[model samples]
Target: MTDGPQGEATESPTRWKFSPVQLDESEILRRGLDAFAELGYAATTMRELARRLGVSHNFITVRYGSKLSFWRAVVDYALAGAERERNQLLAEHRDDVERLRGVVIQLYRMSANAAEMNRLIADESTRDSSRLDYLHQRFIKPFWDSIEPALNGLMAAGHIPRVPTHILYFAIIGPALALAQNPIADRLDPVATPTAAQDRNSTADALSGLVLHGLLPPSGSETST
Candidate 1:
């Protein structure tokens, strides 16, 4: 079961067991993400990750077989988690336009916080052909495919204009890219780094308003947004 930010345990008939095997995998990924983020994918070594995690290099070798395999797994996990969140947000707010706006806003906020993850993607795309391919196929392609239909439904029901959903996606993500390029913590005291949730909703609200205004079709216009 999941715990909320306030430390409340979620209600569930089936409790999540803390399996040692699962914990090991989680530890490796967590450490790898940190290392890869601080030092781009090429500079991040499995041996260094093992050292950071206080584990033997053999531990990583046994789990993923190679450094490349470990990197692939990290990318896969990050993308998979993003997709899952997107799907859940859409399912929960399928009929509410405001809720959908909130979802997009939240997505932007999350993307901003995922600077290291984004850095890995951007840096690797230039050097690793397979990584670029994996990003498109595993992350971006599926994300747009899943969300586009929900957006289409809003148009069909007259809640919004027929503007391409991809445009909306770009508008939402553009700000995050800007923020990721120059992270807030880098300019502040390292100990004072802000939490990801702080200022997230406000930023999202502003972006949502901008998008909705631009995307809403003119009153008498028959064209889709």
Candidate 2:
């Protein structure tokens, strides 16, 4: 008999809840790039990216519009720093040989820092799709374009062995790519891994040695004197 007016119609308690914190745009883009690098374009979706960023899928969709655009944003974000570094190196090192060496060293350091991006590029290279084309045009071409002039100047000045720019590009980047893409490359090489403090310096030294030795003008060459 105690059903008087539905228990006096008690008011529900105000449930205090914290709003989801907004993540920084740069942080979102950085995490997106890392996810794309690890998962590749096709395998990674907005949902997965949002999950990686600890946001909702709508966040990515609303911010980036579509997956293609998101992928482009990720690539652009990842390459922006590289483009700046390349330009700075080119500006700082006017001498052809010195510039080329600086570029090679910079690239080696970049490759070490961006192994996941390199892996993503390696993955993209296997397929001839627009995504790959986008990356080539947007990311890879800018880098090659910046270095081509330096490489050409080196070849013209006889500071480096006269080889095709493409060949020279590979010569400078190939070893670093191999080391970055292959986790076991350090073990495969004769040299032991360096301490954490010397990791970058040691890599720069090894890559610089390889490049300098390979590009040094052969004996009796005009530039060798």
Candidate 3:
């Protein structure tokens, strides 16, 4: 059976109902991400993906119909995983700031390790706004929305300076991308680059500091309601 996008079925229900075949979407995505990391999106082929999956080249065609389709499906799968992790993180934190920091750090750590798949998604995203939109809607946007209230609470408590939640999100993410892109991450000096754990703690401190002490021009200290 071929893997479709996250919401798409591995095989039609009719096919599964008649035949007792099983499919592994995560496994397929793992191999696809591996291939994309090593070969890049344009260079990676269905045959290579099949090779990684220990299946025949025809299997990929049979399952996904085309390379483009398979790649798109992989993107969905990756985003789905990110969304799952996000939900779990949010649940664990339960609308807490520290928990939100953990959530962002965990995602960054995952992306850092997912070199191939992350590369493919990044490249595709540059050319395809929809692909980026899919990622944002599934992972980034919800995460920001979920934490907005907490940020506002911090502001009211005088724990942080009042700022747009989106700005805070942008600040948090800037360092995350840095961690993912850091070359030291791939080497023995992984610690030289910020890991998820590192980002979690540092971001919390940075955000807290920013909240308590407004980082604005001396004249622009006025907080917007």
Which candidate should be chosen as best, given TM-score against the real structure? 2
What TM-score would you give candidate 3 relative to the actual structure? 0.56
TM-scores vs. true structure, each candidate: 0.62, 0.74, 0.56
Better of 2 and 3 by TM-score: 2
Say which prediction, candidate 1 or candidate 3, comes out ahead on lDDT. 1
The residue-by-residue lDDT of candidate 3 on 1-225, one tens digit each, is 666887565867656543432347787777787787567766787667766777766666677777767767877776666666676777777545566456655655665555455565556545656656765766667767766666777568555566666677656555444434435553646546444445544544554444334432244355555
Best by lDDT: 2
lDDT of each: 0.65, 0.71, 0.61
Off by over 4 Å in 1: 1-23, 79-81, 93-103, 125-128, 150-170, 182-198, 204-213, 216-225
Off by over 4 Å in 3: 1-25, 47-58, 79-85, 88-96, 112-121, 155-167, 182-225
lDDT, candidate 2, equals 0.71
RMSD of 2: 7.7
**Model 2 lDDT per residue over 1-225, tens place:** 223476764433222111242666677778887887778888898789878878766766666778888888878777777777788889987777777678777877777677767677777877999988997887678878877877777667677667666777677666776644444654465376532324765676687777777787556566531
lDDT (C-alpha) at residue 203 in model 2 = 72
User: Lowest-lDDT window of 10 residues in candidate 3?
Assistant: 211-220
